[model samples]
Target: MKTLLYIVLVLISFSVTAQKPVVNSAKLEEIKSYLKHFEDNDALLGSVSVFENDKELLNQSFGAIPASRTTKYQVGSISKMFTAVLIGQLVEEHKMDLNEPLATYFPKMPGASSIKLSNLLNHTSGLQNFVVKQDSLKYWLKKPVSQQAILDEIARQGVAFQPGDSISYSNSGYYLLTRILEQKYKKPYETILEERITRPFGLENTFSLNGKTEYEDTAISYEKKDNKWVKLEEFYFPNVQGVGDIISTLSDLNSFMSALFNNEILKEETLKRMLPKDDDWFGLGIMKAPFYNHIAYGHGGDTYGTHTVTSYHPESKLGITYVINGEGYPTNNFAIGLLSIIYDKDYSLPELTEYTPDKLYYDAYTGTYSSPELPIAITVYQKEGALMAQGEGQSPFTLTPKSKHTFAYLKAGIHITFDPDAETFLFKQGGQQFELKKK
Candidate 1:
């Protein structure tokens, strides 16, 4: 009996030793330095929070806004994860089933009778993304849309494919789910969210905007125009309810994600349903996003000028959440840089010096250029004294001059070096270079 007791004590000791706390102040400083590079260059304007095992490692806010832990920003589609959790709660109580057809709640929808709840959650309903249509902005931007009007707009598009035949993202599906939730509980989505998730989790800075909620300390979103920050809330915030209207802080998002992953807010089986498995990158609302060597689970959000990402690595017990009210640089790069720092991996910071080329240089490079290796032709033009390049079927992007003949598109990681004498340019991207001749 004594030997058995000794064996048990040894196992407990090993377990305790295995759960050692992680601390690396140097690595944390590296993350801070990387963020500062973006802030100094006017590339990022927002807040970031990182936690390991629910312990805060870094919490910082940058830019013109007096951002704090309580400052809320519209999290866009990150709200979908919260909606998924509410659905999970209803499923646990036997109030709803994932396999139930949408027709049960939204029979007026064209394909509602065939689309299942799971299809909406996993983005397989094949419902047309109504918001992407040109007419949608004209209708929703100027005024608040009634629930019926939103439904009518979705119905007008009909299904792009048969239900569950394939996967395509549809905000309309989430909108319908929101209406179904309202019907099931006979309560406003705001009240449902407050009672079900925010209040229970003690998330004081998280709330939904239904155009009536009096919210304070919200971040003002901005876009860069002619090297200036232009506020966009006046033109953008309407008609985003249910689909992308929840406002939250970085700390609160981290807390909510940590609670959900820790099984404090969801049953084990329900949480599993939300996480990606079986070769599927998306599960319910949460999706699998790989960061370096870690497989992180979370969702990214974009609405107007705001961009946000919330991800957690279950194996590492790490959570990173950030919200950018003004983004001129790619947010994914920031996520990669932060995670690389935490894992002690090599990463490079952005070089922020700006260079301007003369009009003669622009004139020499202006023309249509194509390469035998590339599938599309690139048209180079000058816009407001700035060099711009547009590829076939893609929008125009401004090129930042890195040298006399070299230009870079930092967001896309493409570099171009012009050869004025040869009337050609070398296009370098993804570590591969191809020479294109002027046509």
Candidate 2:
């Protein structure tokens, strides 16, 4: 969720202006069939909700019992959108300023004197994301982490560049923003969220997580391994508060987006500042997603296991949110296909298939590849009659072949298509692409 909808493929346009509304009974049936396909095939494994002018067009659950429609999956970085709105509220109340220095609240934080609230909101703070470098964090992330310990760790991770120098996704920035909200409101983040956003918006199902691991109607996220669905671990909920700790069902997410677009959360002028102005990659907590020529503004989120996306189209007043706990197909592909059907674009239902290991020589793909775009080199190799890949500073993972030269590790959201003749492969993840040549 560090990068929301940076989709390299099929993201052909970039206009946020309102477009003509497109809806029909046939398209509604198509949408039903489109979603049912995932449920029947077990391609997408969570919940989906779509809205038009505050009317629920679709609300459904996949890959679980009928009661799972109420399951509240952790929405990860989409919580950033909520946090940004809180900041916006405080600014309107004169409790904070967009250009105010972080030092005003957390004097000990590194670069607190230079980093502005706006910098953090737009991801130009340059703060080293404390939760990054998972190799080191994984050892302790599953356990409880204290607020003081978190602040200390943020200080230790320190700055990567001067504040406002460049853009980088920083959970530390949002975590601190959460803390600032608490300081400003003199209340816990959960209480602040309830008083300001959830209760006021009547989003009864949305909540900020603390220590409770077992909640009614909340399914644990998962991944497929050894031909069976297996539970996937997530970050300690409290540690990622106001960054990735909020949990909500698709219904509530749909409502939140609709309420937001209605200007209940912030005034139209303030909302404009939070939207992409001119050519900005992101506006405050928002990101733009494209559906052919239509544009929707919102954010995406990922925890260790779950992935979520939420957006609202101002022109049509359409809101869509998809949350995936696991998938046999890349959630992005399913999302693209779903949107195509919604916009009445030419699209085909995806064929979900399980691959059998092929006898093609894995040796041809074994080598070290370096990309100028990435700091780490990826080393491909063979292990136990299976193809494998390891990025520098990351654990090795088995690759599932889509074709003789195309493979992916779905759990990690990585895909690599090889060109053995040219000794190159294209790498895609979190919607960014890079072409690397074998060394």
Candidate 3:
């Protein structure tokens, strides 16, 4: 009797240990504190949800008007992942081929004969991003654009590079993919998305932005103006269409990601094809990024006044997602901090400080800086009383001074430390450092 009783107790202990949550109260409190810091400073206005397997570890919102889990927000480029999954389903059903040329659908498209479906999925099709071009933006933002208008814009331009030659992010590629889907299915892209992906998964809050004048329960987007939140004017959603027009909630997105990785939406083989090894670190529409020592796969998005990132680690069965309707800080830092705490890694809470540097001191750092190891030269100059840095082929970005010699570009996660005595600057981003000399 004594031996049997001991055996029963041991089994109960094992069961309790096995079912223990991966994250602890201490870590969760730390995460909450970190988010609250941003909220207190008016830098974060959003919702975050982190899940460990089937258990939700954190689901909280911050701001004057907090958003709930069901509140819809425009996910921007993350919509590409949904489009990619649709293509994957078609491929699984043998209705589509990844290696097929886009010319099969739109032969009139410039260089369509050479651009493969894979090229578009991985952003290597050499197509110019119509949304980024000044003239195209001027036209599209003014009114709702038809599919033909977008196609015409794409056709008017030459290929940026040979298809599959190199990787360049092109919204044009995904927009064209949307048209191909419609042509193949003989239905609108939204209809196809509903029939093929969202409906089957029971994703209620995930849908295309069609025939919707206003989104219900959606957070109002804001931009910081004179240190106050200012709502932005609405743009034509249809202009982005399949590229970046999907609206979803945190819960729905988490459900979709969970279903996708669990083989509920795709076959193992089809999923493998979507995760190709590429120079751009993007496979299909998903991006693979490193978190601590583990690799997480997902996509980030930015639109108007919204920023979002959703990623999952297969090894740990952890899914992390956040959407900010207003951002005055780097969104990536919040992601890094959340993931670090989830993994029981060391993460520093954000130190929010506003700096006003003297114009003379800022001007001293204004010059062109180049590194032999890096291909691009960075130009530093003053813009509107702020120090700005611009790399070749990139737009100018304001640098926030962390100290007299240390400056940071929050959006890019770049930190630059100047060595006035040595006349050099150390550029740091993503754990890599490059030394640049002033020219």
By TM-score, how accurate is candidate 2?
Answer: 0.83
Candidate 2 lDDT by residue in tens digits, 1-439: 3323334224666455435667667877787788788778666677778788888887777674343557788888889999999998887788788999999999999999999999999989989777754354543656787888888888987899998789888888999999999888889999999999999988887889878645677767787754457888778888888988899988888888888888888988888889976766678988777667777898888887788888888888888888788766777777888788777667887655546645565667889999889999999997767788899988787787776677877755788898888989999887899999999
- Candidate numbers sorted by lDDT from highest down: 2, 1, 3
Q: Model 1 lDDT vs. the true structure?
A: 0.78
Q: What does the lDDT come to for candidate 2? A: 0.80
Candidate closest to the true structure, highest lDDT: 2
TM agreement with the true structure for every prediction: 0.85, 0.83, 0.77
* Alpha-carbon local distance difference test for all models: 0.78, 0.80, 0.76
Model 1: residue 362 alpha-carbon error in angstroms: 3.2
- Please tell me which model should have the higher TM-score, number 1 or number 2: 1
Pairs in steric clash, model 3: none
Off by over 4 Å in 3: 1-21, 134-139, 278-280, 353-439
Best by TM-score: 1
Q: Sort all candidates by TM-score, best to worst.
A: 1, 2, 3
